[model samples]
Target: MNFLIRLLVTALAAMVTAYILPGVNIKDFTSALILALVLAILNLLVKPILVLLTLPATILTLGLFLLVINAVIILLAARLVKGFSVDGFFWALIFSVVLTVVSSIMHSIAGGNND
Candidate 1:
């Protein structure tokens, strides 16, 4: 299905990103898949609330505060997922940015519908 393909693409992106970033580690492809799922869940359930609560700061920072929120999500996933870890907040931020870029590229290459 489309969802499965997207998940695979995301997992590949996460694995590639983790391999590129020294401070981020994913134990294996399975861990990358789990990481992708956790990130999707967090983005669906938590991101909206976070964006709502941080509206003022987000507005003040010209929407850049979303980057911090993305880092927080990564840190949270690191804690929740057994084989995935980010060294610290700084690493989390870097990992998040890199992951986004990698994911976008992978999705585009995969012809994933922009869902």
Candidate 2:
């Protein structure tokens, strides 16, 4: 199904991010998949509430604040998922950005929505 495909896409992206960034460590493909699933679930369940709560800052920063929100969410996922770890907030931020970029590129090549 579409959800499974997206999960796999995210897992691939997570793997690529871990490969490219020294501060990110994913034990294996299965760990990447688990991290991806947790991230997706957190983004789905918590991101909206965060966005709504931070609407003022988001508007003030011209939407750039969403990047910080995303980084925080990634850190949350790293904490929740075993065998996946981000060294620090800086690494978490970098990992999230890398994941987004990789996933976007992969989805573009696959003809699917990156989100």
Candidate 3:
């Protein structure tokens, strides 16, 4: 199904991004898959709430505060998922940014939905 394909792409991207970032570590492809799922769930359930709560700061920073929120999500994912670790907040920030880029590229290559 479409969801499965997208999940695979995300897992691939996570593995690739982890390989590129020394401060990030993923145990294996399975861990990457779990990481992707955890991230999706967090984004779906938690990110919106965080965004709403931080709306003022987000507006003040011209949306830059979203990056901090992304890092927080990544750190939370790290704690929730076994076999994945982010060295610190700085690494979490870097990991989230790089993972976004990698996942976007992979999704595009996989003919992902524009939405």
Candidate 4:
């Protein structure tokens, strides 16, 4: 299913982040899967509301403030998912970018939906 594929892609991305970023830590693929699931749920249910609330700062920063929001989300996910942790907001921001790049590649390979 598409959801499963997305989760796998996310897990893969998490692994890559851990490998490439020193401050990021993902225990294993299973933990990565759980982290991915938690992140997906948060992004689905929480991210929009956060974006709405931070719209003024986002606009003022020309959208860069969204990165901070993303780091916050990552920190929240880290707290929820054991064995997957980011050392600080600095690492979270880097991990966010790395995850985005890796997931984009995986999604393309899986023919993911843009919608």
Candidate 5:
């Protein structure tokens, strides 16, 4: 139940991100939900391994490299999900940032935990 609420909030955030970010395109509610689910799964499963693998670079970059890794993950999600598209590399980066911000705000407003 909590997870379902979080997922719905995430999907809403994705839809909002798509509305605000020109480069990010989510065709419909279903696409937005799918994209949000995929993104959450990727962040949960793949991002930790990626963070560990790039720990040195992340340290060297003073944690800034995490942004690049996030962008890459968002690009991967966009590629994996149909009807959810990011225009280009630059767009993917911007969309990633927007998505993160929107999701964070939504989660906080909904009293969801970061965990």
Candidate 6:
């Protein structure tokens, strides 16, 4: 299914992030899979509400605040998923950014939706 493919891509992205970002540590493939699942769920279930709540700030910041929101979401996912560690807020921010970029590139190359 497409959902499973997306999850796999996300897990791959997490692994790539762990390799590239020093502060993001994924203990194993299992941890990467878990982190990817949590991130996908958070993006689906929580991100819209957050975007709505932060609409004013998002507008003020010209959409830059979404990066902060994404970092916070990644931090939350790190907390929820075992064996996946994000060193600190700054690390989480960097991890989130790298993951986003890598995932986007992979998705596009794979001819998948960015959802």
Return the TM-score for each candidate structure. Answer: 0.96, 0.94, 0.97, 0.94, 0.91, 0.92
Better of 2 and 3 by TM-score: 3
Which candidate's TM-score is highest?
3
- Residues 23-92, model 5: lDDT tens digits: 8899999998898789889999999999999999999999999999988998999899999998888888
Those runs of model 6 whose alpha carbons end farther than 4 Å from true positions after fitting are 113-115
lDDT of 3 by residue, 47-104 (tens): 9999999999999999999999999999999999999999999999999999899988
What residue runs in model 3 are displaced by over 4 Å at the alpha carbon?
none
RMSD (Cα, Å) of candidate 3?
0.9
**Candidate 4 Cα misplacement greater than 4 A, ranges:** 113-115
The CA lDDT of each predicted structure is: 0.93, 0.90, 0.94, 0.92, 0.88, 0.90
Candidate 2 lDDT over residue span 1-115, tens digit each: 7788888988998998899999999999999899888988899999999999999999999999999999899889888989999899999888888888999898788788535
Task: Give the better candidate number (1 or 2) by lDDT.
Answer: 1
Candidate 2: residue 48 Cα off by (Å): 0.6
For model 6, name the residue pairs that clash: none
lDDT head-to-head 4 vs 5, winner? 4
Provide the clashing-pair count of each candidate structure: 0, 0, 0, 0, 0, 0
lDDT of 4 by residue, 1-115 (tens): 8788889989998898799999999998999999999999999999999999999999999999999989999999999999998899999998898899988988898889987
Better of 1 and 4 by TM-score: 1
Backbone-clash count (model 2): 0
